[model samples]
Each structure stands twice: as structure tokens, then as C-alpha cells.
Target: MKFKKQIFGFMDMLRFKKLVPNRREALANGPADPLPTEYRTNVLAHRLHPGRMEVELVDAVMVTPTIRKLTFRRTDADAFPFFRAGQYVSLQSPVGDSLVSRPYSIASSPREALENKLVLGVEDAGFFSGYLCRDAKPGDRFVMSEPSGEFHYETLRDKKHIVCIAGGSGITPFVSMAKSMAEGDEPYEMTLFYGARTAQQLAFRDELDALSAKGLKVVYVLSDETCDGCEHGFVSAALMEKYVDIRESSFFLCGPQAMYDFVLKELAPYDLPRKAVRKDAGSCGNREVSDPRTFRLTVHVRDKVCEISAQENETLLTAMERAGIDAPNKCRAGGCGYCHSKWVRGEYVVADGRDGRREADRKFGFIHPCVTYPASDIELIVPVGE
Candidate 1:
């Protein structure tokens, strides 16, 4: 028994000797070189997740008096990253001394992405839109983030039939989906209830009419005017029932805040499952300030501290931007949580239906400045810029 144990111990010692050199060799030489195939796949993955891409405005067409469809072409690459039909891109441009960014739904289909082209419909609403409409030219260069949003259809979660309720410029994403369906890319039936104040305010009417040839159904709901071959009323529950069956359909809503409020109330009778409903955060409504006064704001970012004035009505994000503070932000709708900051000491009101912070974040003194309005003197610690 002693001889047998000695023999086993000797074998174990020999095995350890072999492993020691092998481990030494592995440490001396770092990781092995990746194969050419692996290198190519990694490059492709980076292209898909390229944090930001440079694009140039190739064309701009007036879709309506207030809406313009800007076509952007990739300048640095042959192809832009492919996006789901209902995704959005955040475009950044210099307004003056400060850089501003806004989210716009890609009106172009995924097929167009392969050709390095994407479309965005901008409505003349605020400062950014005003700049795009009045000052932007075809040769302008801008940086846009990769597509992001949860407004798209998922086959596992959504029904085969979808009812889209769009208002004003909110019709952009649905247009992309309709175009994708027309091209046999998406496999779902859609009925669009597009609302506008007048016939002239309805954007992409000609394109939508052409898509009807491919079996897409569109019903124009005019609120302020009655027109031939159009529904002259709001996108009420009664109107939806009169046109299609809602019980077996998934509902997708996009538009201004008022439309969202009204539509949500109207749809309450159905009591649809949460998964059956989706909304674009871009259209979340802004709140009016009861006290239209400006207050002082103290912001601490990284090692620098600055003081600025914030209006009671304007969001903290807007105040920071106007004060030339390059605060980090994306989705500006309070959904992405990118501009989340530490609310050191402040009295503020978060807009209803726009607070997307997790319960833990809310409990731990974090706030999304994009949707938070200052009611009194404020101080916050914003995350340092990348």
C-alpha cells in the first residue's frame, strides 16, 4: 500500500510540473489572435451598435405647412444601422453656443437603412423645430444616435391586428410601419386613425393613399373641419368601434399630450391588457406652469459647479441647455433615464405620465430632469458628460 501511494504521488507531481509550464506559457502569451471571420463579425456588431453616426441632410421636403420631412444620408459609412419600423433616432445639432438634441421617429423603412438613408418628420413646434424649419439646409451635418424605443410591434406580445391612433406629427412611426408592411417586410394588419385639425394639416396623405394599394387601411379623423371621405370628429372610442373591432386588436398611440389624455380616457371602457397597449414617449405632453417665474439653479457636475436660472415652466434639462451647460441626455421624454441626476435639494413637480424612473431610483433621490419642473430654488448633481 505504501508503494502504491508513492507511485500515485509521483504521478501527481509530474502532472503539476506539466501544468505549471503550460500556465506560464499562457501567461507569457496573451489572448490568441482572433480569426478573420471573428474580426469581421465583431466589426459588424460595432456597426450595429455604433453609439453615434454622422449623417448629412440630403433632402428636405415639405410634407405640410408645419411639417417637413428631412432625408438624412450616412456620410461616414455605406449603410446606416437597421432599425425596427417604429424606432426613433436622437439628432444632435448646435443651436448656438450650446448643443441641443431632439428625438424624431424614423419615417423611413428598414429597407432604406441599407441604402444609407433615413427620414424624419419635424413639426414646427418649439425652438429645435423652428431651427430645423427656418435655418437648416440640405448640406447640414449632424450626429444621430442609434435607434431606440419600445413602440414597435412584437409578434409574441401583440395581436396580429393593430389599431394605430396618430395625431399631428405623431403619424411618423406608423408611416414607417405602413411602408414596411407595403413592402412585405412586416407581417401584420394595421388600421390607422390619423387625426388632424384640417385637411391641410394631414401629413403624408399622398404617400398613405399610395400605401392603400398594398392593403393598408387609413381613416382620416378631422377635428376642426368636415371633409369628403373623412371622419369629421375626434378619434373617440365610438369612432374606433364604428370602423374596426378593438377587442381583438392591439392599440398603438402617438400624438400630442392632449390626444394621449383623451384617447386613454376613451379606451378605458375596453380595459385592454397592458401589453396590448403601447405609446411613444416622444409625444408625452408638456405641462403648463402655475407660477410663471424664474428661479435660481445650482448644478454640480464632476468637479465644476455653476449656477443658472430656471423657469417655473421649462424643464431643468432645457434650463441647463439654455445656460450653456452640456448636460447628458437622450430621449428627453423622461423614458430613457439617461439624463437622470441626483436631486440634492429642490422643490419640483414631475409631469404626469412622463415619470419613467424605477421605484428604487425615485426612492434614492434620483430625478429625471427632462420631465421635472422646478417650483422653487433648486440644486442638483448632474452626471458628468462623456
Candidate 2:
């Protein structure tokens, strides 16, 4: 045993002594080329997550009486970042004394986004949307946030078949989803139920017609007027069940509160799982107050401080935009937490069901300015705008 231990120890010593020479030899034989200046992973990361970008409006056409289809191209790059079909981007621009932005779902396919094109169907309803539909001209530039939101289909979480119920301008994301399916970029069967007040109010009819020929299922439901192919009524579960199996498919509803309430009630008897239904979170606008009170808002952005007047009914984001503060925000519905700020001191009310802050954010007094309305004078520290 002693002799065997001595031999093994000698062999180990010899192996340990050769480590330095072996390493030196390996190093000498290695390639002497300098490290790469750019890595593919980093390049891919930059491509996928550009944060924000400047975009130029290339074309604007009236898709319906109130909805305008606006096309955009990235001014900084050749193509916009490819995103999920149903995602939305917030476009911001200076409108007179105020900087305004709104989230619009992508109407074009992700493949079109890679070809230097993106599209939004903006209804002529809101302040900024009115500008886009009426006053804004081609070549006008705006800042666009990255595509985001949890409204897109997840293969693992959602069923293979999706039932998309769209109302008014809510047809935007479904249009993209249908186009994505037609383009073979996404793998899912989509059955879109587009609802409008009248057949004349339906947007994207011609495009949807062409896609229908390509095997994409589209049903036009008009409430006021009847057409040869359209079903004249609200898109209730009875109307949907006529075409597809609701039990074997997931539901995607994008529309006003009334439409959501109606559709949800219609499907309540089905007793579907929570994950089986998804809804788009539209931005929270001003609350309805009988007489809104004005309160002073002190905001700190980096080293700069500004004083703005906030209304009891309006959100902090609205106040900052009214003062041209350019506060950072993406999904202004409070779900994205992009406009999260340090609440130093304030009396505010978060919009009902709009408080989406995490436990850490709540414990640390961080508030999403987009959904918070000031009840008294407030002081906050906000991040720089994207």
C-alpha cells in the first residue's frame, strides 16, 4: 500500500508540474486575433429592444368615416422592430402647447413592420387622434414607443383557435392578427367578429374581404343596418357560437367598456377559465367629475423641476403633457408601469381596477402617474421621457 501511494503521489506531482507548460503551450497555439468589436447577441438585443424611435408618417387615408389609417416608417432605421401581431405602440407628438400620445394597436402584420412599414387605425375621437385624422400631414414626425402589452396570443397559454371580437376601431389588432395568420408568421386559426354600428362604419372591409378569400374567417356584425353577408346585431355568444366552437377556442375582446361588459356576460354561462379570455387595456383617460378642482403638481425630472396644474379628474400624465413636461410612458393604462414615479407626498386616487403596481412598488410608494389623479397638492420624481 505504501509503494502504491508513493507511485500515485509521484504521478500527481508530475501532472501538476506540467500544468504551467501545458497552459503556456495552449496559449501560444491559440489564435492571436483581437476580440470582436460587436457581438451578435448584443446586436440582436439592440434590434429587439430599441426602447423608442422617431417615426415619420408616410401615408394617411380615411378607412371609415371616423377612422384614419396612418402609415409610419422609422426615421432612424430602415425598418421598424418586428413585434407580435397584436401589440401596440404609443405615438407622441407636440400638438400646439401640449405634447400628446396615445396607444394604437398595429394594423399591419409583423412582416410589414420588418419592411420599413407600420400602420395604425386612429379614430377621430380624442385630442391627438383628431389631429392625426384632420390636421396632421404626411412627412410629419413623431416619437413612437416600442410595441408592448399582454394582448398577444401565447401558444402555451392560449388555445390553438382564437375568437377575436372587435368593436369600432378595436378592429386594429385583429386586423394585424389576421394578416399575420395569412402571412404565415403566426401559427393559429383566427375567427374575427367585427362589430360596428352600420355597415358603412366598418373599417378595413376590402382588406378583410381579400383575406377572407385566403381562408381567414371574418364575420361582420352591424347593429343598425343589415347587409347581404353581415349579421345585424351585437356579437353575442349566440352569434359567435353559430360560427365556431367557443369551448375549444380562446377569446380576445377589444372595445369600449360597454362592449366588454356585454361580451363577458354573454360568455359567463360557458364558465371558461380565466386564461381563456384576454382583453386589451386601453389608456385611462380623465375621470368624470362634476366640478374638477385644480391642484399644483411639483415634478422632478432628473435635475430639472417643473410646476404644473393637475385637475382632480385628470391623471398626472395628463397634467405633465398639458405643461409640456414630456414624461415617460408606454401603456398609459397603469398596467405597463412605464410611467412609474417616486411619490414623495400626495393625496391621489388611482382609477378603479387600474392600480397595477407590484408589492415592492406599493411598499416603496411608487405610483403610476398615468392612472393617478391628484386630490391635493403633490410632489413626485419622474424619470426622463423615452
Candidate 3:
């Protein structure tokens, strides 16, 4: 009986082995493409992380002579992605024959995005701003990337209290934060030191005043003119020390190049932790080009070759746009690495501290054209736009 049982067990094992699928046979019979799963077909995930969305300008209000508040609403999608208060969206615009993209910090709270509205406070300065302010209308269509940036406050990384230093249009992001905090979306104490030339140049004054009444500390510092109730001076370390406990707080800065230069120098004596100081990725430092001559630029995109004249002071991205070439770019500040191209030939000058390329990228002769200026006639292999 034991022998019979042993033989039966052996037979059962053999049958089980035969029923198991063979690896090679399974591979040969598998479908050529993967079938979509619930994870891949999720609607909420796609809505929250859509790469780009089509939006139309619904309203435009002039905040100041140089600043305009543009309101955008989604055209095709049901809603815009929810973004942090300090993140910015890149708006793509066609200027003449070329397409250009620029990032603007959202001035509205995250709740506003849920209502299908995004507000941008644009200051007329460069080519893109000129188009947005002068040429764009109420019904003009635009393609905007999802909100992105590393300028927002985080409870895990930042302290409970924050000191914000803003200049010019830089005050927009802080406005979003103030609104969010007032609405109970964010739980952090904020004190904003806003700098401007005069009272007339201060954008979003009324909105900020309302938020200030709701517990946001707002200090207006005027450099050129002093009001009866405003502080008269730049945002200096002395002024910051008067309001904030430097050792127990985090500092956030958003402004033009000159303001960043002066403010960072002013804060250096505090010897704060590296993580304690955060500057908006959009805050670009000043770079001077000694030469003022035009150089030849040869760009290779897929099978097409584009030749354009580049100025010594302007970036390669600017030259391509001027020539009506729609080159891809985001965070024009050089931190996003979206406009990276192969340097086929020629010399270029990358601003110091603006080179965010990886070590391997630098070693292999790749450069981000957004912040790379032509030092001489240049040749590049630019990636084709999707």
C-alpha cells in the first residue's frame, strides 16, 4: 500500500509540472502591447497632472501702469490642476513668427484653480510681456503648462514662521500665499516686506490690505518715495531684524536681479542655515555681456536646419524665437532643463550659478539654451517640439 501511495504522489507531481505554464511559451503567446489598467486609465490622476492645457483670457485688469492682471479660464478641460500658492505656470504665446513661453506666478489661491480660473500678474518688461500686455485680448487663446516651482512653504522643511521679501512683480506669489492662509488653506505665520519705487507702482494693494486685516503682516518699503504710513528704504537686514527673529524663522525672496543681489548680501551676516533661505527659481541674477555684436546661429531640429542671427546679450532661445522657430522652454531661468540642446559647435557663455546641467551633460557638451548666450557663431542640435 505504501509503494502504491508513493507512485500515486509521483504521478500527481508530474501532472502538476505539466500544467504549469512554460516561460518561453508564455512569452511567445503574450500580447504585443500592454492592456490599460485602472492605474493607467485613472481620470483624477490625469486631471491633476496634465502636462498642458488650453486656456482663454477671460479678463484683464490693469493693476498699475506697468502691471496687468490677466484672468484665464480653461477652454477644453473641466478644471485646472491644483497648484501650491507659490508655483508658476508657463504661458506659450506667438510673437510675430516665433512662439515664446514665459513663466508667471499665479496670484490667485489654489481654490481659484478649482473654479477654473487662474490669475497672473504680468509686468511689462521683455518681448513676451509686451505681447501679453499690448496684443493679447479677452478671447485670445493660450497653451499653458501645469504649475511648477520650488518656492512654496512646507511645514516639514520650513519653520512655522516665514519672512517674505518681495520686489516689483515678485509680490504676486506672496499674494497667493496670503490669500491661501487667510482662507485657512495654509497654517503658517507670514510677514511680507514688499519693496517698490512708489505707492502707485505697488500692485495688488487693496487685496493685500484686506489680507493684512485678516492677520497677514504687510510692510511696504518705498525706495524712491515715502508715504506717511510706509517705510522709506530698501529691504535691508536691519529692517528684517526689526520684525522677524532671524534664528527662528525662514526667509523667502522673490524679486528682480538687483533686489536679489542686494538682499542676499544683506542677509549673509545672519549665517542662517542653507535650508532657511529660499529664493524663487524665477529670480534671475544679472549678467553683463561685454560684446554687442551679432553672431550667426545654426540650429538643427530633426531634419530641418534653421539659421538665425543672435545678439551677444540675448540668449540662443531668444534668437530662435526671433527667427520664428518654436523652441521648447520652461522656467526660462535655466533651472528646469527643458530647453537642453546639443552643442554641435561654437562658443557660448553660461551665466555663473545659472548652469543647472548635470555633470554628465556638461561633460558630453550639452547646454540649456535658455541661459546660454552666444559668445561666437554657434551650431546646435535642438530637439524637435512635440
Candidate 4:
């Protein structure tokens, strides 16, 4: 019995020795060559996920007043990168002393990215839109990210037909999809329900009309001025039913916050699955109404508690910026967790629809300072950026 036990022990030792070589090899490789420290930090902490991108600025003539398009081309000499349709790219720039990043959806066919070109449309909004409209020229260079967003027409998930309800600037992505359909770049039949205040504000009208002439169904739902060829009403279920068959079709909505809120109520009548409907990003409806009650916000950065005035209805990041307290933020809408911070003690209300807090972060008392407003005076721990 003792001799048998010794033989079993010897076999166990041999098996352990056989497993050690693979473990040693993995350790020697050391985590797949560790990306540059800056790149790693951005991915984990700053949300600056890096991708090999080609960046160039190309002119896109509107041929109309308020609607202009800009095209970006790949600078890579080898091959251009590809991106999914309805995805967005982050453009980073210095807004005064603070660095800011904004995400814009690609309004070109998915194949365009492979051709070293991706397009985005901007309306008359004075922020980035105004800059793109008035200042962006052919030779100008704009920084951008690889396509990012979940608002694409998926074959496995979405139905055969799609009724894209677009309003104002929200018409961008649909234009790309429509162009793709016309060019046979994508395999889906799309019916666009476009809403505008007037015919003058309707973007890509001629291009859409041409696409429709080739069998792509395009309908303009104008809110003002009943024209001969346009429907005069906001996009609702009844309106959509009049044009496209919505029984098994999906509804893709993109517009201003007020328009989306009203459209969601209008769409509530349709008992379609939750996956059948989608919306895009926009400004948080919580306007900055200054409150008289001001509290001091003590932020611990690099082991120093820097005090700043926490204004009512103002975000902590905004307060810190005003106080010359430099911090990192990419998407100020709170969707990007770049400005995530630990709230030591305080109450805050992140605007509805803008809150993208992870479940674990909520459980652990972490908050995104971009969209979080001061419900009470508080202290927080934040990371300093170089």
C-alpha cells in the first residue's frame, strides 16, 4: 500500500512540472507588449481609446444654405480603415485652455470608410456646427476618432424594412444609409421620414429625391408650411403608417431633445420590441439656471484638496474649469466615463438620459462629473491629467 501511494505522488509531481513551462512563457511575454503608457492610460482611465486612424479634411459643398457636409480621408499610405455605418468618431481640439472632444456620426456609406473617406453633416447650431459650416475649408485638418456608436441598421436584429425618422441635423446618418442603398453598398431598403421647420431647412433634399427616383422611398415630414410635395406634420405612428409598412419594420429616430421626447410618446402606441427603436445623442435638457445657493467643492487631486465654488445647476467639471482647476473630460454628456470621479460624500442628480453610470460604479459611489449637478455640497477624488 505504501509503494502504491509513492507511485501516485510521483505521477502528480510530473504533471505539475509539465504545466510550468506554459505559465513561464506567458509571464515572459508580459501582457502582449504593453501599449504606450499614454495610450493605456487613455483607454483605462481617460476613455481615449486609440485606433490607427487616417485624418484629413475634405470639402463637402451643401449646394444649399444651412446644410453643409465635411468629408474626412485617410492619410495612411498603405490602406484605409473601415467603420460601421451609424457609428461616430470623436474629434478632439482645444477649446480655449481646456481640451474638448465631440463625437459626430458618420453620414457616409460604410464602404466610404474603406475608400479613405467618411462624411458628416452639420446644421446651423452655433457650437461645432457653426465652425464646420463657416470655417472648415478644403485644406483644413480636423481630429477625429474611429467610428463609435450603436445606432446602426443590423440585419440579425432589425427587421427587413426600416423607417428612419430624421429631424433637422438628425438627417445625417440616414443620408449615408440612403446613399449606400442607392450605390448598392449596403443591403437594406430604407424609408426616411424627414421632418423640418420648412423647405429651406430640409437638407439633402435633391440627393434624397434622386435616390427615391431609383427606388429608395424618401418622404419629407415638414412641421411648417404645407408644400405641394411635402407632408405637413411631425413624424408619428399614423404618419409613418401612411407611407411605409411598420408592422414588422423598425423605427430609427434622431433629432433634438424636445422632438425626440415628443416622438417617443407618439411611438408608444406601437407595441414593437424595445430593440426596434433607436435614438441619437444631443445636449442634456438641463439648462444652466444659476442657483443662489452656492457650496464649496473640495476636490482631492494629487493629494491636494483644491476648493472651488459649486454652482447650482452647474456640473462639477464646469465649476473646476471656472476655478482654473484643470481636469480631463472627453464627452461632457456623461456617456463617456472619462471624467469619472469618486464622490466621498454628497448628493447629486445626473440629468436623465445623460447618465451612463455603470452598475458597479453606482453601487460603489462613483459619479461622472460631466452630467452630475450638485444636489448638495460635496467633496470628490479626481485624477489629474498632464
Q: Which candidate is the best by lDDT?
A: 2
Per-candidate clashes come to 0, 0, 0, 1
Model 2: number of backbone collisions: 0
lDDT of 4 by residue, 1-386 (tens): 99999999999999898788978887888877666757654544322233425477767677458778787776643234455566667665444554444566678776766676777787756555666777767876655655666778888988888888888878888877787777776678888888888888888787788889876788887787889889987887788778877777887888887888887887787777899888876644244665446888889998788877887677787777666565666556777686789999877878777889999999999998878888778899987753
TM-score: which is higher, 1 or 2?
A: 2
Query: What do the candidate models score in CA lDDT, each in turn?
Result: 0.89, 0.93, 0.88, 0.74
lDDT of 1 by residue, 65-142 (tens): 999999999888898888889999988888887677788999999999989989999998888888987789999999
Cα lDDT of model 2 overall? 0.93
Flag the better candidate by lDDT, 1 or 3.
Answer: 1
Position 70, candidate 4: lDDT: 80
Residue 373 displacement in candidate 1 (angstroms): 2.0
How would you encode candidate 3's per-residue C-alpha lDDT over 23-111 as one tens digit per residue? 66788899999866667557778888787789999999889889999999999886788888899998997877888888999999999
Between prediction 2 and prediction 4, the one with superior TM-score is 2
| TM-score (C-alpha) between model 1 and the true structure | 0.86
Worst 10 residues of 1 by lDDT: 282-291
Q: Worst 10-residue stretch by lDDT in candidate 3?
A: 282-291
**TM-scores of the models, in the order given:** 0.86, 0.93, 0.87, 0.75
